[model samples]
Target: MAKTLKSWLQILLKLVNSTIGIVGISMIIYSMWMARVWQRHMEGSSDDFFSFSVIWFILTFLGIGITLCAISSFGHIAAHTANTHCLSCYMVAIFLLLLVETTLMADIILNSDWEEDFPEDPTGRFDDFKDFVKSNFNTCQWIGLFMFLAQGCSIVSATFLRTLEKRQARYCESDEDDIAPSLPFLYHPVEPLPCTVADLPGAPSSLYWC
Candidate 1:
């Protein structure tokens, strides 16, 4: 029963790992798209550039790194020897990256620089930009926050599972040792018995003890 339960737990872990890996890949792709959009927007502007672009670029690279790390970690776990330390590191890095993204998003939304020299018309573009900002602030930013939280939870779960597996292995070894006495000579060789009844001439013929 314990073996079956462990097998099912392993399957569940694999499913969770797969789900997280897929999400990580999706985040990387989305980050790339965001980077492209930011780049295009920056190209159209000569003086409106801010530190937010730099932060976004950093986050984009971090997302790619985290995605690759997650894929590699999943492969290692499939092979039965995942590095939890590396996974933890990746999770921390992702959290930091998400924090930067959230900060930049918030900064862009709150600070409105409305001047006559502003490249895009303040009234029209500002309203449109405000709507765009509002949509992103409410949607994509929240998604980022959730992803960050999920990564943290996954890291904790992985650590706990890894420790549990190690403990199980130790317990199995100890249990085998405890049962060794009752199963003495379990690995020893035994002599073979006589093949036929005729080989035992002294035995009772009517009883046919063989």
Candidate 2:
């Protein structure tokens, strides 16, 4: 029963990670499309600064997509194997991710001068980022909050699965202990059957024939 539950939990973990990965792919695709559209719109432009800024933002978004994709990949591995090390590393990575995300969100919500907190990019992309965030503040915040919750849920589920793994290991060890005492008896050597040419004075053949 415990093993069955663990299998189901692994399935759930894979599903959630796959969903997150799909979202990352979508983000990557959208960012690429936006970059293409912007490039086409500015085909004949000579504004280097603006072009650079747009490119920088596009790359930033692309990086986020890649990061998420990577996290999802790690999650898939951890789920499939249920290895202790993998699970522990995944939990740490996810926790750190959550911590950073929470911090950024808190800064956004609580700090009016959050823009000042972000370092200025050489290509002025930070200004564009600020504009974009301000324009889509509500949607961005909600999405961030959603991801925060989802990531937390993933960690919690993974932790539960880890505990289950430990329990399963312990159960196996106990079973081995119970079986160990009987192993010698179970595998004891058998007496040799009488040889065809060996006949003894006893009822059954027990010695070489004269």
Candidate 3:
């Protein structure tokens, strides 16, 4: 019963890891593509406030996200195989991903300086930007938040799975030890079969063959 439960838990972890990784990769690709489009739009502008470095920064974060997603496969493999070193590596990957995502969320949630620029625009740029974001980019932010939650879940699941692996190893060892005492009797050498009374030596008219 314990083995069955462990098997199910491992399967659940694999599914969680795979689903999150695929979704994360797709999100990174979509975000990077959008960043490129924004960069092209900004490149045609005369404003000096728009910086290509900002786009590059965004791209860097997205690239990190992609790398994290790629490494998630290793986590799944480690969990399924119950490899302690591999699980440690997997935990590190998950931790790094969580760190990056938390940093991103913090950046978005704490930066209030953009409001200062809202009052200086004469060409309705600020209003247009807000409108565009409300209509489109808002969903992207929510998706990023969801990614944070998913990565958090991966961290937790991987941790519990690691513990489960250790418990399973101990259980197996204990099971083997419990059955070890009976092994000698179970595999003891066999003796020859007993002969019938007619096979007795020096018995006349015995029916036994040589």
Candidate 4:
């Protein structure tokens, strides 16, 4: 199976999904660390004004990480199930995710004051993420390219393979049905040939046997 294109594609999808899931887990861990840090800040301060901002900050990170993890999980499920409907659903999810990402990219590239479009971050994670991207632009670009290609190519090929396999299965079943009727005819017993003069050489002549 690994020798074929489909098996290698499935392997690639699994690897990509696993990497995305791990990134999501890392994001969740970072959010947890932020929450811990903010806990100390809240305990030290007497103002209640910062509570909503802190909660929102935490929830925003959590939501993003959960969405990533969910997408990765769905990819895995679709690969395993090999169901056309599940594959279609996974593709739709990927499309929506890509839409959101594209919007983010557009805003970052086109908007002069994109930062003004969002509320202030209490934990500064967004700023840190932005700085990280800026510092590692090439790395992030390459990673994104790999992810986009892996998901797009693998899913499309998987769907094609699934449909092809289904057709092959139906054709094989029809072939088997067509071959079934001739089984008894092929295996029927054969009758023995009549004895020749060679067998009665000691008792009779070849003319008498004939």
Highest TM-score among the candidates is held by which one?
2
- Tens-digit per-residue lDDT, 1-210, candidate 3: 767776776777677677667876875876666666665666767754245444444554477667867787787788678676787788788787677767755765798674663235433333554687788887967876776676666677777777877887898999999999999999999997766646566777666442
Rank candidates by TM-score, best first: 2, 4, 3, 1
Model 1 ranges with Cα > 4 A deviation:
1-20, 27-134, 180-210
lDDT (10s digit) by residue, model 2, range 76-125: 99999999789899889888877887788789779998877644555444
Which candidate number maximizes lDDT? Answer: 2
For candidate 4, lDDT tens digit of each residue in 86-145?
Answer: 767877777777778789889988999999998887667677778999999999999888
Comparison by lDDT, 1 against 3, better one = 3
RMSD of each: 9.0, 5.0, 6.7, 6.2
Model 1 C-alpha lDDT per residue in residues 1-210, reported as the tens digit of each score: 655554554555455455556666665775566556556666856644345434434364456657655653653364244344554554465456556757766665576642332343321334444577577877866765665665555555556555566677789999998988868578677887755544455866634333
Every model's TM-score: 0.45, 0.74, 0.60, 0.69
Which ranges in model 4 have alpha carbons more than 4 Å from their true place? 1-6, 46-52, 169-210
Give lDDT per model, in order: 0.55, 0.80, 0.69, 0.74
Candidate 1 worst ten-residue window by lDDT: 114-123
Candidate 3: stretches off by over 4 Å? 31-55, 58-62, 111-138, 185-210
Ten contiguous residues minimizing lDDT sum, candidate 2: 117-126
